[model samples]
Target: MSSPAHAIYSSTLSLSLQGHAFHPQYGVQLIFNEIAESLILCGAICSQNPSCRTFDYDSSSHRCRLFEADLTNGAIIAAASQTSIVGSVILSASLYASMYNQSCSACQENRYQTCSSTTNTCQCPGNSYWNGSMCPLQLFENAACSQIDACRSDLNLSCIINSYGGFTQCLIGINLFTIFVYENTKIVQIETMSDYASLRSNDGVVSPNYNFLFDENILE
Candidate 1:
């Protein structure tokens, strides 16, 4: 009878290897070896494993390193041709177990809402009434000014008088009552109600009792 023929196991770098297992998600592979067969086997293992991000193979030891996360490629390995053939299969069941556990946990609540990580928090916009991330309850309440008239300067009431050559006064409807004149002060006290009414009404009539002479030559 002929000697039993040796079964040659084909190696591949693709993720479709038979009987290969890996994380369920988010995995890749990095290859570091120059050997064609080793590269092929590493790729095949990673292809079969869903969560294997990459694979690293040391040619010096014919060792295959598998990672469940991202890996750096193009790592140089010397004396790769002299290394002995080691076992083909190496498995780590707890690969990336800690990462999965941490990602699944909930973060603490942020009071200011400014936490930008996976945690949900409340943050305030710029120029808002509140100083911090959260808006205050009494922000912008009972403001001193309104949108229509901020300073309350538009009173709309004015006064005109016949004295001092038809002088006009701006009557600002505020708490104070005052008057101003451009000329020198000339006192003419009104003792009767008729004199006061004539000055107040601005009817263009000068009272005879309060008459004062002015020099005509002063105009020139």
Candidate 2:
């Protein structure tokens, strides 16, 4: 079967940036007596069952394995086989509260997180934030981040493109890193402080290390 174009996530958060998302070296040892045609189908089947936290789908044999472990410490990402698909259950807000009743009884998460018997939700108790795998002390400024939801909202942070355009980081507001007004031939030298330093704590003005002569149109 073909994978679905979109998804409705779930509460089974097997996310761990520190390492593989979940499963021990022995792996998520329990295989559900279930089979799925695709990875998405395995997740869909997990969504229907409240006790499921993560699933591994083997495309070669169509095996849908499930897990219910204390995720205080997160796991790394790897496949039992090249054809295996692994994932956690990160549900959406709309369907979130519905998963309050039933979930895994085992709490393998780190000290910062706790499993609420009544709500069936594992949560970080204080200022610490959950970074997919385990709860960290705090979210720092300029930290590498992939999603806006992963950043600390109380600090009014957003994930934006970085200077090199290679990765994203948590910066204040929707601030664009830098802008170069490319002129066709005019080489207007900017004898000014560094452009990006404005957002830094020491105020806007920082010394430039070196200057580059513009030669965008010049041929070899």
Off by over 4 Å in 1: 1-37, 71-220
Report the lDDT of model 2 for residue 176. Answer: 30
Name the runs in model 2 displaced over 4 angstroms.
1-22, 25-33, 70-74, 91-220
Whole-model lDDT for model 1 versus the true structure? 0.29
TM-score for candidate 1: 0.19
Per-model TM-score, in order, reads 0.19, 0.32
Q: Supply the global lDDT for candidate 2.
A: 0.43
For candidate 1, write residues 81-126 as lDDT tens digits: 4443221222232222222112222112211112223312222211
RMSD of 2: 17.0
1-56: candidate 2 lDDT, tens digit per residue: 12222222223444333212345333323437477888678777765554455566
113 Cα displacement, candidate 2 (Å): 17
Candidate 2: residue 198 lDDT (0-100): 19
